[model samples]
Target: MTLDDALAALKSHVEEGRAEGMAAYHKQTREVLGIPNPALNDLTKSWRQTLTVEERVALADQLWQSDIFEARIAAAKLLTQARLRPDAAAWALIQSWVPDFDSWAIADHVCMAGQKRLVADPSRVDAVEGWTQSDHMWTRRAALVVTLPWTKQNNPKSDDLAIRDRVLGWAASYVEDHEWFIQKAVAWWLRDLSKHDPDRTRAFLDAHGEKMKAFARKEAGKHLT
Candidate 1:
């Protein structure tokens, strides 16, 4: 379907009074449709099944440029699938959106889409390293959020273990960042790592926990106990 068709479908499901609340909660300046996520999820699921990859890419790009809250989210959901065998175009589109991230919800949604692509080709980690060095906090934060899969490998291959250590190094670099979200991202990675690899998680905390914000440290250690 076309962008107009997709947007019309989303607009049909909007909750009348929720837009203001969503905008306020997200601190977003863009138009908010107040469409619940489940509706968006279902819509994108249907779109994914119906549309060709090129069609989905075009629609996702249009929806993202519309600057409407839920449309951007729909754009992300459309690309969240794991099995795009030759996904160079999809990966490129997701990367293009990184510099524009201003809010957590949108960034996280896009990052979720990105996680699949990154896993499909781990070489993208080198590009993600560039995001960690970006001036935009959300871009920096996306590096960790997108690599979260590395945090949970109970029976990791040697390659996976190396990836885990690489991400941990990124987290350690972030420990000195006083931004609440950065600290939270570092803590989040450690917390998830704690579930499958407690010793490494504990070691991270021991080395960098003292430097993290108290709330982040607490969150990182919450599952440890």
Candidate 2:
């Protein structure tokens, strides 16, 4: 379907006063239609059922360009599938949106879509490595956000272990950033990792806790025994 068509569908479900409160909560200046996520999910799910991968990619691209809050989210939901064949377009589109990430909500929906892409092809980790060095705070944080899957493997194979350590290394480097979001991202990775790899979590806290913000250190070690 067309951008106008997709947008019209999105506007059809707008919940009157919700948009204003959502914009205030997200601290965003963009157009917020206040369409709740379930509606977006419902709409995109139907769209996904009908569209080809390429068609979905084009529609997602347009929705994102519209820059309305719900449209961006719907764009992300459109590509959130894990089994899209030849997902190069979806992956590339998600990567292109990274630099524009200003709000955690949109960035996170896009990253949820991206997590599947990265899992599909781990070589993309090398490209994601480039995000750690970006001047954009959210881009740097997105590196951790997108790689959070690496934190969930309880009995990860050697390659998975290596990837976990690599992400931990990035978290180590992030301890001194001081931004609340950065600190939270680092702590989030560590706290999640602690569930599957307590030893590594403890080591990270021992080595970097002093450098980390107080709340982050506590949060990171929260799951450790």
Candidate number with greatest TM-score: 2
Candidate 1 segments whose C-alpha is farther than 4 A from its true place: none
Top candidate, metric lDDT: 2
Candidate 1's residue-wise lDDT over 1-225, tens digit each? Answer: 777888899999999899999999999998998999999999899999998898888899999999999999999999999997568898999999999999999999999999999889998999999998899999999999999999887899998899899989989999989999999899899889899999999998999889999999999988996
Per-residue lDDT for 110 in model 2?
95
Cα error, candidate 1, residue 138 (Å): 0.4
C-alpha lDDT of residue 122 in model 1:
92
Q: State residue 144's C-alpha deviation in candidate 2, in Å.
A: 0.1
lDDT for model 1 comes to 0.92
TM-score for each predicted model, relative to the true structure: 0.98, 0.99
Q: TM-score for model 1?
A: 0.98
What are the RMSDs of all candidates, in order? 0.8, 0.7
- Score each candidate by Cα lDDT: 0.92, 0.94
